[model samples]
Target: MNEYIQRCEALIQELPHDAVRQNEPIYKHTYTQMGGLADLFITPTTYDDTQRVLKFAHRNNIPVTLLGNGSNVIVKDGGIRGITLCLKHLNNIEITDTQVVAQTGATIIGASREALAESLTGLEFACGIPGTVGGAFYMNAGAYGGQIADVLERVLVLTEEGDFLTLGKDEFEFDYRKSVFSKKQYIALEGTMTLEKGDVVQIKQKMDELTIARETKQPLEYPSCGSVFKRPPGMFAGKLIQESGLQGTRIGGAEVSKKHAGFIVNVDGSTASDYMNLVRHVQEKVNETFGVMLETEVITIGEDLKDPVND
Candidate 1:
């Protein structure tokens, strides 16, 4: 084995046997079923374990990648190098009255359900967001006039230097699908959501209504990274793409969703390259027609594309 691979294996032995894996396929962990292999994939089950792995990587000068539920991201075909940490095993939820404390790995939908069980009302808007608590907090995810910023009270995070810290709501700087987390190298550990007590029937009705709307509007049957581009100022990205006549435009295996022009879906064995090309094409067309530059909301990682789209 090479020196780096040997060191990775030695480090894996220090963690729980089942928690660490070598050359694991990253495609299985993502929503779009894309990506190559990760040289080292660690599924830490506890906060301490997460800290240990991060510390080890930091000391060894190894690259570390933080991955949540893999909803709003695209992993390149060349995959990721070094340690890719997945916190899915750290999932835990607790409710005390109108406050909900959720680990980073817990799904936002799961947290919303816990809120519904406790008859909390504010999280009904998040029941349909397909991401983890950490991912939601990282992006300030929102829909239907409700956002994580409206309910989030505080968050616990581990900084790049391995210090644990708690940040209050005001410190988060939550805006349209953005947070201060985007600017910092801190990893979210857990979040506390403050909600209001409401009638169970009313909350369930709202959640159900939003769920129906999502099913009717989004291309749920296909694999996608969810809303490829951010809303550009006063304009909606989907409307602009649709107006540019770019809906259902295909590049390789990736196609803009006919149902929602904002989404790029894996129609037939699409690679990360296919998705990016389609995104660029739509951007060019929309810019040419409407003169608005669309910015990508989806996070792209790993090596550069081998076959890039031609202009």
Candidate 2:
């Protein structure tokens, strides 16, 4: 084995029942169907294992990136440097009286479904969110007028100091598509959500209705991130882009969805560059016409292929 791979393998041995991959294709892990290779990817099976990996990375000064369901990120084609930590193996959901405890890798949709089965309410808004608990908490992801901050009681995170701490809702500092946890770059391990007992039939009904609404409006059939841009203040992002006459606009193989202007879909075999360029094009044109800056909700990583504005 090479030096870096040997180092990662040694680190892996310190953990229990964890898997590691060298040069894993990141595109397969993301919703956008675009990304370069990951130098190293590891999924730990237990909290202790997760902590051990982090401690090792911290001590060695190896750069680490935490990944969830890969639903809202755009990785550049040049690939990622250092270790990419995936929590997919940490998925677990347990119920206790009024609260539900879940690992970071557990899907929000799965959590919402469990809520319905347990006759739990207040999590119906997350039935359609395509992400993990950690990702949801990091972004304060919400829909249908409900957000993570509304239901989250506390979160277990691994601090940079190699200590585990429980942060309450206030500590998270939830906002529109942002959180203090995100800013602090803390690694989330588990979440404890407080929900209410309600009628299972009613909860299921609400989830069904929301799912139908999403299906009718959003392009779920195509491989794309859920939303491309955050809603600018005082204006709906999709409406503004649509009104700016950018629907069906194309940058290489990427195109703003004709059905929903807020979406930048890979209509063909779009490279990461294509999608990013399309995003900037829409942003610039909308800003020029409406005098409103459209900020991206999509998180971008790695080096740019070219300056987007010039394309």
Candidate 3:
């Protein structure tokens, strides 16, 4: 084995055998079913285990990447080199009256369901979101006029120095598809969301309506990184793309969804490059047509191709 791989394996040996995997395929983990591989993939069962792995990587000067549910990201074909820590194994949810405490890996949908079970109202807007609590908080994910910022009370995160800290909603600096977590590189460990008591029937009705709206509007049948771009100012990204005559535009296997122009879906066996190229093409067309530049909401990472396709 090479030096880096050897070192990573040694570190993995110190953690639970089932928790650490070598040369793990990242494609299967992502919503788009695209990506190459991770050099070392670790799934910690608890917060302490996560810290131990992070501490080891830090001390050894090994690079570390945090992944959550892989729902809103596109990992490139060249793959991630250092250790990729996926928090899926840390999923745990607790309901205490009007509060829901969710581990980082717990799905936001699952948390919303827990809230519904407890007849809490504020989380109804999140029932259709397909991401983990950490990812949602990282991006300030929201829909149907509600956002994580509206309900999130506080979050627990691990700092770069391996220390745990609790941050309130204000500290998150929540905004449209952004949070302080993106800039600070703090790994979210857990979060507590506060909700108000409400009629269970009303909560379920709202969730159902949202779910139907998503099903009718989005191309959920295909693999995609949800919405491709953030809303540009007062204008919607999808409307801009649609108005630019870019809907159903295809570059290789990736295509702007006919149902929703905002999404670049894997119509056939699309690669990360195909998706990225399509994104660039749409951006160019939209910019030329309307003087607005679209910003991507989907996070793209990993090595760039040696000879990437022209955008």
Candidate 4:
């Protein structure tokens, strides 16, 4: 047997207690409900298991891809190579006074709800965001004029070297839809958010208002990668798409949402290529119309589907 094959088998045996599946379909894990497979999809039961898996992958030179809630990522049809570490089982949210601590796998919505339960005021903006805490920190996720940068206190990240490091919010170099964790390729384990003690009624009211607004505006019923494009310099991406007449534009099964121009929805069974192609088309049309090049907020990973060879 080849050394790589030997390593794969050995790693599986090492993590016997973890939920490890080989050549597993990843579509079910993502919000968009489309993907190919993961060579080794692992959901570690404990933090120690996470560390051990990382150490093993590092020592064996096996690439490890850390996924949070899979809310904003696309895995191509060719599938991912090596290990795919899903942190969904590590969900733990702690609240003390006005500060909230959330693990990587904990949903931002869940964290916000916890904040509301405690009468905290800062996370109300995130009550409708469909990403995990780690993802929110990685991308500085924002909505309703509030963002992670506004309340984040610190982050705990796991390095490629298998060491944990704590970084203050200021150290992240936070900006619109970006943070240092993405650039550094660090795996964020958790985040601390500082908030204000507020009246429960007011907290609930704000959260309810935002929830109603989100439900009213977004195409929440369909499978979609929430907002497909980043807001370009003082311009709303959805507005630009609407003005460009790209709404309801369909390529294969993927369509630019008529309800929300910023989102591309899977109206039928759509491949990653369909979504990708539609995104490109929207970018081209919007640029032609308004002279502003649009950037994507959604992330695509893995290889493209290869065309079949015929004799």
Query: lDDT (CA) for every model shown?
Result: 0.89, 0.87, 0.90, 0.88
Tens-place lDDT per residue, model 1, 1-311, is 53445767657877899997787877898888889888888998888888888788888888888888899999998788888989898799999999999998999999999999999999998999999999999999998899999999999998876678999988998878789887786789999999999999999999999999999999999999999999998889999999899888998889999999989999899988888888888989999999998999999888753555551
TM values, all candidates: 0.96, 0.94, 0.97, 0.96
State how far residue 50 of model 4 sits from its true place (Å).
1.2
lDDT value, residue 77 of candidate 1: 88
Per-residue lDDT, model 2, residue 180, is 80
lDDT per residue for candidate 2 within 117-166, as digits (tens), equals 89999999999999999899999999998999899999999986568999
Candidate structures ordered by lDDT, highest first: 3, 1, 4, 2
Full-model lDDT, candidate 2: 0.87
Model 1 TM-score, all chains together? 0.96
Give each model's clash number: 0, 0, 0, 0
User: Measured by TM-score, how close is model 4 to the native structure?
Assistant: 0.96
In model 2, which runs have C-alpha deviations exceeding 4 angstroms?
1-9, 15-18, 304-311
Candidate 3: tens digits of C-alpha lDDT, residues 1-311: 54557887767777888998778888989999999888888899988888888788888888888888889999998888888989998789998988899998999999998888889999888888999999999999999999999989999999876788999877999888889988898999999998999999999999999999999999999999999999988899999999999998899899999999999999999999999999999999999999898999999988765556663
Q: Model 3 segments beyond 4 Å from truth? A: 306-311
Q: Could you say which candidate leads in lDDT?
A: 3
Kindly report which residue pairs in candidate 3 clash with one another. Answer: none
Native-vs-model 3 lDDT? 0.90
